[model samples]
Target chain A: MRDIIVVAGKELREIVGAGGGRKGLVRELLFIGIFGLLFPLTQVEAWLSGGVPAAFALMVPLFLVGPHVADSFAGERERGTLETLLATRLPDRSIYFGKILAVCGYAWAVTLLIILASLLALNFGADVSGRGGSPTAGSGESEFFVYPAFVWVAWGVGSIASGLLLASIGTFVSLRSKTVRGAHQAMMIPLFVVILGGSFGIPALFRSLPPSTQERFTELLESMPAVSVVLWAVGGLFVIDLVLLGLGARLFRRDRLISD
Target chain B: MTLAVHTEGLSRRFDGVTALDGLNLAVPTGSIFGFLGPNGAGKTTTIRLLLGLLEPSSGNAVVLGRDVRRESQAIREQVGVLLDSDGLYERLTARQNLDFFARVARLSKGERDARIRALLEEIDLWDRRDDPVADFSRGMKQKLALARAFLHRPSLLFLDEPTAGLDTPAAVGLRSELVSLAREEGVTVFLTTHNLLEAERVCDRVAVIRQGKLLAEGPPEAIRGGGKRKLEVTATGIRPALVARLMNTPEVIGADVDSEGRLILALADGAETAPLIRLMVETGVEVSEARIAEASLEETFLALVDEDLNGRSRVESASGEHPR
Candidate 1:
């Protein structure tokens, strides 16, 4: 456990300090600068309302996690630090989990911070100084912006589940990739497929189904409670995470790592 | 003997091609043992096997008194390694690289700080501790790497071509420090290098390998086999007739006057030297000095490798097999 923390800590430091340190962290810093502070301030009223804006709490973190995930295994090999780290007394599991945990922890923490900053922007913006909308959006009474209780739970669970899933997939890609660029390129393939398939292929396939079947599917989705659908989605993602993580552990072998 | 590293029939094969053949070795505790070989001789493979980075195909090894297969983590905890790569994090500062590894070694706050400082100063990199490793020269990085390997004060260290990129002075300094570490601290050093002179100077015992097999293993002098030695005789009057006289004798397989007018005689296996000296004196060659020229580690290494190659060829021809 202690070794895990130590490895995780070093990994975080390296991630935070890569490229040229602060100058190299332009992307990450820009992320917090925009989403956390500026975006909320610019769209105060809509951000305060819970819907698509609230969904950013989940989507933003996963977006932020993608590139960093590639750095977990493939980056170390590219940077020539993998062999030395493997030579250490650190147990294999610790090193594996440590890197995955670091990626998740950094992305998750940033997500939470973005949420906190957004709240601060909405509640304390110049337009909302008197708890009423000012020049930022339409002039109207606006109470302190706060997420509903369910909003917090929903996005929090959603972000974590999606983050782990993406990171697990990234782990497998990174282990096989010789370069970070290669890993990222490989990761993009499935991501595009999933997004495109969900966006067009599945719907197209559904349209190809019999009209009666389409009606039946619509009826079933509509009959299911919103909370139950969310729970089912989260549960399915969790199972995929487990399977990918199990395969990742199998892939993380000392000899294979060295040979690769 | 109390062995720090022992291997029995240890071997590794890749896709039916053997990288390390069946081998046996016993490295004594608290000694600087040099593993010498040309490129592709499986020196790095042996180190990897002992460190449990790679599993052996048909045998086993014990390092630091733990079975390499079952107790690799234990062995890793007590041994330090500097492989083909320096293994330094290039983006991090020199201090940060050492500190991170020191932390991984689980040193206390106080120990980590003190050790990092001492090592930086020892390597003369304390002034540049804040500089990233990528900014340092190859020699400086190599020196820092050596310090990092010693930070935890490991009982056994496996250094593969540790000084390959260092300057002469830095290499000398590191060699002295290596001797000091092994002598005063009782640290066992398993070093592999192509530098036969360096091996001869610091290594208590050395082993030579070729084609993934052990060609010779012993003290430097021992491996420079005693049979068929060379003798150099310097005299006031040396001529072709004298060389002919020496060559005619059964003990002298070959004889010639060298650039300095010394008769260089290649003696037959375990041949007596007294008869040659008597013959030289009787020939009235006015012999001034006569001494058996000892073979250096490099010469011995080459001779052993040549013998192994020729022997392998002969065996292959006899067995009607194609030479690899």
Candidate 2:
């Protein structure tokens, strides 16, 4: 356990310090500048009231985690550090889980920062727009914007969980890939499937289903509370995370890792 | 004497091609043992097996009194390894690389800092401790890697080609340090290198392997001494007739006067040097100096490798099989 923390700490430093350290920070600031400040300013009232914040919370961390997950193991292999690390007294599981934790932890932290910045931007924008231009779209009373506690807990924690899931999948692919580029290429397959299928295939499948099946599905979804639906989604993602982690452990063999 | 490493019939084969053949060895504790082999001769493979990084096909090894197969993690904790690869994190500073490995060895905070400080200073890299390894030259990185290997002060260390990329001064310095460390600290060093001269200078016992088979194992002098003795004689008034007479002798296989007026004789097995000298004296040729030239480790290594290649070829020819 101590070894895992040490490895994770070093890995976190490396990830943040990559590209001479300043480049990563610059890129991160660029992200915050765009998504946190500019986008939130334009979406002022809708950012807090609509689903934009939730979607950004999910997708932003996932985007941040993708390259890191690919770089974790494959980067070590490319840099010739994997075999040395493997030969150490550190257990295999520590190295595996340590990298995953580092990736998820960094992405989650950045995602949360982005969300907080977005919230701040929304507050400042709401005040400016309310005083000078127009009141908040629907409500007549213009007041200080405060996101609900549930919103904080939902997106803050939920984005981390989503990052963990993506990181797990990335670990599996990275462990199998010989290079960081190879890992990224391998991860693109799953990313594409998820994006295209979620956007079009699920809806297409709904259209193909008969009226009776569609009505039953709609009734079941409607019967469940919104919180329950979120819980079910979280539960399903956790299950997938566990499966990917298990596969990753099995793939993380000394022979396979050292061979290439 | 206690043994630091013992292997019995250790072998590894990949896809019907043997990378390491059935081999047995006993390396004494606190001795600088050299493992000499050409490329693909399985030096790295042997180190990996002893470190429990790779499983053997049909044999077992004991390192630091622990079974390599079952107690690898324990063995690794107590051993240091510097493979063909330097294994340094290019992005990490020199101090960071050593500190990281020091942590892996589970040193206390004080011990880690102290050791890192002492090692960096000892290797003369403390000045550049903050520079990333990638920014360092090849020699400097090699030096830092060497320092990292000994950072934990393991009882046994496996260094593969420790001086390959080092400049002459750095190589000599590292070689001297290795010798001093082994003698003063009682650290057992298992070094593998193509530098036969370095092996001859530092190794207490050296083993030569060719095509994954152990060719020779003994002290450098012993391995070199096993072959036929060579005698160089400096005399005046020497003629072709004397050389012809010496060549026709039963014990002397070949004789020729070198450019320096020394009669170089290649003696056959079990040849007596006294009788050959007596013949030169009887021929009225004045004999000034007669000394047996000792074979060098490089010559011995070449002879052993050649012998193995010849033996394999003969077997292959007899069996009508293609040589691998």
* Interface RMSD (Å), every candidate: 1.2, 1.2
Which residue segments of model 2 deviate by more than 4 Å?
A: A126-144, A148-154, A219-227, B232-245, B254-264, B270-291, B312-324
Q: Considering every candidate listed, which one attains the maximal TM-score?
A: 2
Q: Which candidate is the best by lDDT?
A: 2
lDDT for each residue of candidate 2 in A79-98, tens digit (9 for 90 to 100)? 88887888888988889888
The ten-residue window of minimal lDDT in model 2 chain B covers: B313-322
Please estimate how well model 1 matches the true structure, expressed as its whole-model Cα lDDT: 0.80
- Model 2 pairs whose backbones collide: none
In order, the candidates keep a fraction of the true contacts of: 0.69, 0.53
Give the Cα error of residue B141 in candidate 2, in Å. 1.1
Which predicted model would earn the best DockQ? 1
DockQ, per model, reads 0.61, 0.57
Model 2: how far is B179 from its true place, Å? 2.4
DockQ score, prediction 1: 0.61
